[model samples]
Target: MLTPTGEIVAEARRLGVGAGAFNVITVEHAEAVVSGAEAAGCAVILQISENAVRFHHGRLAPIAAAARAVAELSTVAVGLHLDHVESDELFDQAAANGFGSAMYDASKLEYADNVAATACAVARGHAAGLWVESELGEVGGKDGAHKPGVRTNPAEAAAFVQSTGVDALAVAVGSSHAMTNRDARLDHELIELLHDAVSVPLVLHGSSGVPDDELRAAVRGGLVKINIGTALNIAFTGAIRAAIAQDVTVVDPRKYLRTARHDMAETVTKALRVLTGATP
Candidate 1:
């Protein structure tokens, strides 16, 4: 069943649990997430990032359509979300395309500018009845704000949410993006402080780098929405690489793609268990 991201996040926050928001680069990724969610009997978010739109030649309609179709067909609850979107035009398209939620990323701008841009975005998203999310700090990856010590100030975070009226907030707290290794240490105490300071659900980006025990600990501290991307890419790419390497003569793409999708699904199920504190 297709579910609203706000509903899922709200439930998780209310129950003091974590909601998994897994990024999707292709249709298979979305399918695998839903499949894993069904196996775990949990609701999962399907996130499509701005980079993915660029990968598809700056077109979001096709990928958005594919995700919606997959979500509608799934037995488990699924929510479609646009992740790390910085363009107003693209953000507009999210609501036009029937996305239940979107994260308007203006964290790259100066503090005041980010708040101004994000506030306007929140108003626009709210007008379209979309649950809006904005990032306060750069969750360290790529360039700029990649420093390991950078973390979101609980006082500043509370002010940003208050000024922007965003439905949720993603704060930097030690994790960096695109980390293949899962050794990132999160500030558990800061997470608790931010949770107490902010009125809305807290989102943790760059969560792929956080270990399972840390993830469970983060949830216990106050993270409601957990964003994961690189881990799936790692799982998918690794499985495909191994399958192809083992059989040099195999030429069919489906043979290897099947293994990749299955492996990714397994990863999602395990992550869900950790976030929800279920016995794996």
Candidate 2:
């Protein structure tokens, strides 16, 4: 059931639906995501971030192989994606490492530099048959360079997409990254304008901070690909905390990890339902 990431995004765009992309740090996370997608009966993208690569001490082959295996065994359609890829070497390795799509993040660089770097990434990704995603302006960060106030201009976004030849563009509307609270307010009007203006599919990053109602509204406003990471980490960590606390005598790692995995799966299932408007 391995599907192309572009197919999922394009179909979602045509239907005005959200194509959920969940980040996976561990093989268990991949399994949980697949389980959740199957429960919701929808296709999903499993993302591996640059930060995650660093977490694994710069090793990607093992985890990437595991994710590919999980995707092959999945009942629901699944695709692998690379998120927030800052390094050229890492981005270049994505296709060979089993990723169907990748987001090249040059948002930290100067505008011209970002365009140049992202354009280069787009060409390489396209050559590898990978769906290329890039950000015009960052969606969120505590840093001054990419804060909550940053918003992508519709015209500029359109131009960027056209110039870079990217498959999709992540626009800054209102969401902030790593928000523990789901209270981010998105500009529905801007989202619609961006969608109409841009030639490619629109992406909403830092979606974990967005509320469910707003999420559905974003889809209605033409957000096709939604990147969600912090929410899964929140669920995974919260469950681990609860499980370990309930049984202090538990020495087995699997005992607590099992609880965490199940909770994360439930969270993913809910998110998929919200994005796809699936029945509970």
Candidate 3:
């Protein structure tokens, strides 16, 4: 069933578990995520990033509509979210295109500027009946700048959430984005502190970098929303490579794409199990 992002997150919070949000760049990605959520019997969030929109020539409606269709067909609850949207135009487009939630990322700006921009975005999102999410600081690994030492200050994070009136807060806690290696270490103590100080559920961006045990510990410590992208892409591409290697004469895209989708689904299922502590 199609569910609102706020409702899904609220449920996860009530259950003391983390909700997995997977990035979907294509229809196959959305389908795989829904399949994984159904397999795990847990709610899932499907996210479309700004870069993905750009990849489609700044068009969001097509992909967003596809995701909505997938959600409608899904037996398990699913939410569509716009991720890392830095522009008002794209944010408005996402809301107009049926995204139930969006992340307005202005972390590159100065602190006060970020707050002001995010606050405006929050008001707009709420007016459109969308749950808003925003990041306080850069999480790292953006454009090849890997600053693993950077972390979000609990005080600043709480203040940002309060001032912006965002429904969720994504924080920097020693995890870097675009990480191919799943060995990132999260600051469990900071996660607990942020959870205690902030009114909204804590969102961990760059979660694909964090290992399974650390991800489990992060969720147990207080993180509620886990956003993953790179890991799924890795699994998907690996499957495609393996499929081609096994059948050198295969020219049909569906043959290899089927394997990719299935592999990606398995990865998402594992992530959901780790986040929700579901029995496999």
Candidate 4:
């Protein structure tokens, strides 16, 4: 069933569980995520990122439509989410095309600018009846730590959420974006403190880097919406590589991609279970 992000994440929060938000780059990615969601009988968020939009040549309507269709047809509730969108126009574009929620990344800008831009985006999203999520200071990825060794301050996080009126907050506890290895260490104490200070559900970006045990602990600590990307990509690409290596002359795209999608589905299903506190 198709539902709003607020409804989906709220349930996870109420049940003391975490909701997995997977970044879908292709139709196969969407199918894999939906398949995983049904296997777990859990609600999942399908996110289309800015990089994906760029890869699709600045068009999200087609992909967004397909995702919405999948959500409606799926047995489990699913939310269409726009992830790491940095531009106001793109945010509006996604909301117009039918995204249930969007994360406006103004973390690169100055603190005041980040707050203002995020606040404006939040207003626009709320006006369109869509959920908005934003980050405070900048959760630095490979671009070097924001402010050289800073994590999200509980008071500051609460202030940011209160000021912007965002439905969710993505904080930099310790994980970095685009990490291929699941070895990033998270500040569990900060996660709990932020949870105590803020009223909204916390979001953990770049969750693909955190190990399975640490991820489960993060949810136990406070994280509600967890964003995973590279991990699934690894599964997809790994299968693709193996398929081609096994049959070098296999020129048919469908054969290799079909196997890849199945592999991705299996990995995603495992991740979803960990997020939902079910045995893997």
Q: In order, how many clashes per candidate?
A: 0, 0, 0, 0
lDDT of 3 by residue, 155-219 (tens): 99888887999999999888988899988988899989998999999899998989999998999
Clashing pairs in 3: none
- lDDT per model, in order? 0.91, 0.89, 0.91, 0.88
Q: Mind giving the per-residue lDDT tens digits that candidate 1 earns over 83-154? A: 999889999999888699999999878999999999999999999989999998778885564555678999
Clashing pairs in 2: none
Model 3 residue 225 distance off true place after TM-score fit, in angstroms: 0.6
Over 118-175, each residue of candidate 2 has an lDDT whose tens digit, in order, gives: 9999999999989999998777763455766788999989888888899999999999
lDDT of 4 at 27: 88
- Candidate ranking under lDDT, highest first, comes to 1, 3, 2, 4
Better of 1 and 4 by TM-score: 1
Alpha-carbon error at 280 in model 4, in Å? 2.5
Measured on C-alpha atoms, candidate 4 has an lDDT of 0.88
